[model samples]
Target chain A: MTRITRDQLLARLRQEIPETTPWEVADWLRDGKEITLIDIREHEEWVQGHVPGARHVSRGFLELQIEMVQPDREAPIVLYCAGGVRSLLAAHNLQELGYTNVYSMAGGFSAWINAGFEFEEPRFLTPAQRERYARHLIMPDIGEAGQIKLLDSKVLLIGAGGLGSPAALYLAAAGVGTLGIVDFDRVDRTNLQRQILHSESEIGELKVESAIRRLHDLNSDIEIKGHPVALSSENALDILREYDIVLNGSDNFPTRYLVNDACHMLGIPLVDASIFMFEGQVTVYQPANPAKGIEGGPCYRCLYPDPPPPGEVPSCAEAGVFGVLPGIIGAIQAVEAIKLIVGIGEPLVGRLLMYDALDQSFRTLNVQRDPNCPLCGDNPTVTELIDYEQFCGLPPRS
Target chain B: MSTIYIPTPLRRLTNKQSRVQVEAATVREALQALDEAFPGIGERLLDANGEVKRFINVFVNDDNIHTLQGLDTPLNPNDKISIVPAMAGGTVKA
Candidate 1:
């Protein structure tokens, strides 16, 4: 008997999949019965053109500010991005999260443009605006509302290096309402490759401040809040609650648990992602649903009942991460956050996605809730926040 | 007699022995037997009222005892039991 290669098996699986098209959605929209068309592309993309009268919320702000921005949760909603990849993904995300009538413009705005629709001319920028937004406007996915979402979003980044870099940059360019950074360390030369939030000139400066300076320069509309103090048992939950979404980009376990617990208790959906060398994992943690049986969603404690003994696992400093690993995973975290905020897509609440950069392979492992999890168990024992450092058996900084 | 395998963190109480032999018909009995030999090791394994800590996981060979009867998980003679602390990493930055 011959063994089938992985590619052959994947191709067979792809063949079995059904097609998703926009004409069905276009027809649905044209009928004008009871649906809202969402132009998921950037504001510049929307300004230069969009489906007329379509809501102009960008993907970045949509997820973080959904409850505030989209008051009618029951409204039939459809989303479209540049080429439809992001929009299709966003539509599937919305469907997964209990949105009944979500749809994606199958071909997205590119297709919309191809259909010879009229568009608002791209706006001219002042010299300062040009200097600040030169890189962002060039990218179709992150033009105007995308940049505005960056300005409007309040994202809490647990780490300033690696994964936090791209997440912050994209959020800034997308115009997230506010960007909150939590990092106690100073910029080290080693962080430049992946921690794009910091610059070589800013070495030895606080990571949060460095990120703030660069982000402010990038987009003055964005509010950058810096928390230079380390996240600890005393302040983790409170700090996390202030932000619309918490991005876990830290390189340690204790902080991950703290962030998870805070998000779970606060009912603020968490956009979680992690990187280890060449491999990375991304997931959304929604505390509202326990039936999904996802550990992290219930709380980090649900997944990791206890922290590995100190030194049992090597740190990123010791294990050496691929320079680009955080970039990929961090960007996905931003996507999940935006999806959650806008209430547009299925927000990875129950699924844990893993990426192996070496083979360019992605896999997901089934995560089950610990029936006896202290945080979200049938008879939960942990009711309030405990000192994360104490929970992890770490000493407080002097 | 069955052997109990202890993970890295709790091994200091076991004299750094990965595996130690103890005689007991049930998991609770085996833990008691092990506790008699090593005084403080049981505290880490069992809480104040002798309930297992939520973080410490016990396995009879490959199957987790938590799915069975937890500390009361029955163990036949010659069975292998292993205790491991869950891998908890990532959270907080200093």
Candidate 2:
């Protein structure tokens, strides 16, 4: 309305707002300063590249989403754009909303690149992906960004049996990009009672082979890898290295300890679940990764240092699981894996969730990180994966 | 009186009963009482040293006994004690 040109307006705002150069922002981030970075550029510009660890809140949505990102008005916040101009506007708007410590990146992403600073290329959801993950996108928890994460994540299932059946189904349905299934056993009629991923028509077929066909029919776009071999300590580390996370549904002590030790060594979180008769247990064993800032939890060895003496505990086949137990437990494992991938919700690390179907109750017990744990403890032991079968007191595989 | 949740594996020892009640003041006493009611359960839960086997976890209410006072953890009235053993069943193995 007033006779002010764009240059004149920019000059006036420059004096009113506080600004920090890309060098200063880099120093703050390197020093681990408590600062929130918001990229106030359009979606296209942001997907190309942006300041690493910056939240993308386009200029149009800055006012709407700023509160959710930074509730404390006095907290340090930095906003950047393609250049430095839009960030100034975003900072001004935030100030009007009573933000007291907002700073604009002097030259935005352009300045960051010129300064030879790091930038991250964010993955975006395609139009078809947008429609497919529309429900997830609508939720504030798992938006477009989170949907992209699900697409880029790879999850490995230790088995394609009762628990793996439902877990893989939901993980695939949720659009997890890569699903690797390791199972040497073939589908038997007994498995059909609960393993929904296999059908009666597919009896005697290799479980991994049957699983690939079932998952393809469910989601053709997703990649399904079949490792039709037994998972041994010899191969666990190599196979687990390819996955972002592991879902353990293994039925034997040798495999459980093997997978657990391998995951800990790799610093990959494991969503471990098991069913016995009508009862089930679910917990996440996350090894501490100091570099990535992931807190450690009580690992499998911490909870169960050694397997029950042989013959004292009945085998799963003899235990006789209920038809619906694995369904509930496996779905929970899938949910935990998704949470890990999207980085949302309070993970079940350091806690064991016990489900008693007969009583219709869920119980959570705290699992402590044993200071004397042999695998993950103050003093180091178990430096590498060992013979799980011999350790479990079972006959070694020949 | 406190309630001890007998896991499915131990159900056979407790006459196929899932929940067994015990009258005791400490976890050790409760487990002892459980043994008196259901013979052979003590052997299944305790090792040669009369302590919970390394593979088994004992809980008082929502906390593991290891984090508390171990088997000496005191139990209040109607408190729930759980004896959890690591289960490895994921498939209907033959």
Candidate 3:
């Protein structure tokens, strides 16, 4: 049997496969029809820009990963590449794999842009920002649009210690427009082991102050708001209202519950992370926004209804955390926060990511909304923020 | 026998052992075995109704038991079961 050349294969597949113009696909998306658009490009091309909401499966792994992405073979699937060639081949492969309604975009991404169809690209990047985020701008996922979203987004971090250190650094470096840090504690000598934001000279300085200085140094363009006051019921809502999302880096149960309730009430996404010893966990608590295409998902309260009795759970100090544990978890929180702001990729709204550094393993558990949750449940009894310190068995703040 | 990997928070209950080998055919029995070897372990995992607690997740060979048969999910020998609790700690230091 004679093996066909690449050109011959392309010609043969083109003859049988149907092609859809960029305008037609754009109209389908605009009309809110249920269709799956896939980008079969390399990672470099994908990060530069892609059709918003289009799932990316590189040409090399299309066969391996397509089943997981589009399980229903009968679903309408559109594939596009830089040019039309790669996606045409990918569409042919999908058809061969029994995908009944597969179509290749006639002119690929460039043609889509030429036709003035809505495509996602990095826009409004200044020379400095473009240079600073060159790597991100080049990425199809975090290109100009995603970078702009990061710059336009506001994120409040609950604590400026362990988890907050890495999260603040990365978010600021990633060019998050505004960062609000809530912390009243001073940087202690012990914090130097894990809190990278503060230096030895800054010991005894307020954490929020140190964080602001360090984060500014990292990215002078972004604004850093240092709230050097302890977050309490009196000011939690007011402080949180200014931000689009909240990151819970507080260690105590009271603050955890407080942040959760505030974010849930405000209907803002919360990227929550925790680390103790060699273990860490990260999850995003994004309440449903039907208008934004986000399905209603569980909040933190849905996972752990009530805080564990104060003594039942140990803090990082008591358990003696691995120095780098928060770095790992906090970085993940930054990733989730960026993804949420950019509206790209799957956020961890209904999933729990557990990492055990000692074993070098990561596990994600499926989390669902609890109808009985007091805060976010179907019959939520917690319409207002209460005294979380008392609820978590901690002494009321003086 | 299935190997159960314990999370750090629960290591104290298991005497700091990260992984424990237990002879059991189901997830429930494995929990019972863990409790037998280490007292009070079952209480943390199951509720008053003997159901897996809402906050706890038990995975059998990387597949969530919820998607499987819940507590009755059959366990084959050499399977790995991971018991993870809901982690909520966020403070830098206590």
Using DockQ, give the best candidate's number.
2
Q: Which 10 residues in a row give candidate 3 chain A its minimum summed lDDT? A: A306-315
All candidates: CA RMSD (Å): 16.1, 4.8, 10.9
lDDT of 2 by residue, A1-398 (tens): 68998899889889989999999999999999999999988888888998888998889999999889999999999999988998898899999999999999898888899999888987777788888878999999999878888999999999999999999999998999999999999999999899999998999999999999999998876999999988887888899999999999999888998998999999999999988999999999999998989878999999999888777788678778899999999999999999999999999999999999998999999998999988899886998989887898877676
Task: Give the candidate order by descending TM-score.
Answer: 2, 3, 1
Model 3 CA lDDT for position B5? 90
Candidate number that wins on DockQ, 1 or 2? 2
Return the lDDT, model 1, position B90: 35
Q: Where does candidate 3 stray beyond 4 Å?
A: A1-123, B43-80, B88-94
Candidate 2, chain B, TM-score (2 decimals): 0.94
- Model 3 agreement with the true structure over B60-83: per-residue lDDT tens digits: 875668668989999899998988
Q: Alpha carbon lDDT of residue A168, candidate 2?
A: 98
DockQ of each: 0.19, 0.54, 0.24
The model with the greatest TM-score is: 2
A303-398, model 3: which lDDT tens digit per residue?
676666566666666678888988999999999998888988888878888888988988787777877888877788999989887786677677
* lDDT score for residue A378 of model 3: 78
Candidate 2: the clashing residue pairs are: none
Residues B1-94 of candidate 2 have per-residue lDDT tens digits of 9999999889999999988999999999999999999889999999899999998999999899999999999999999999899889843222
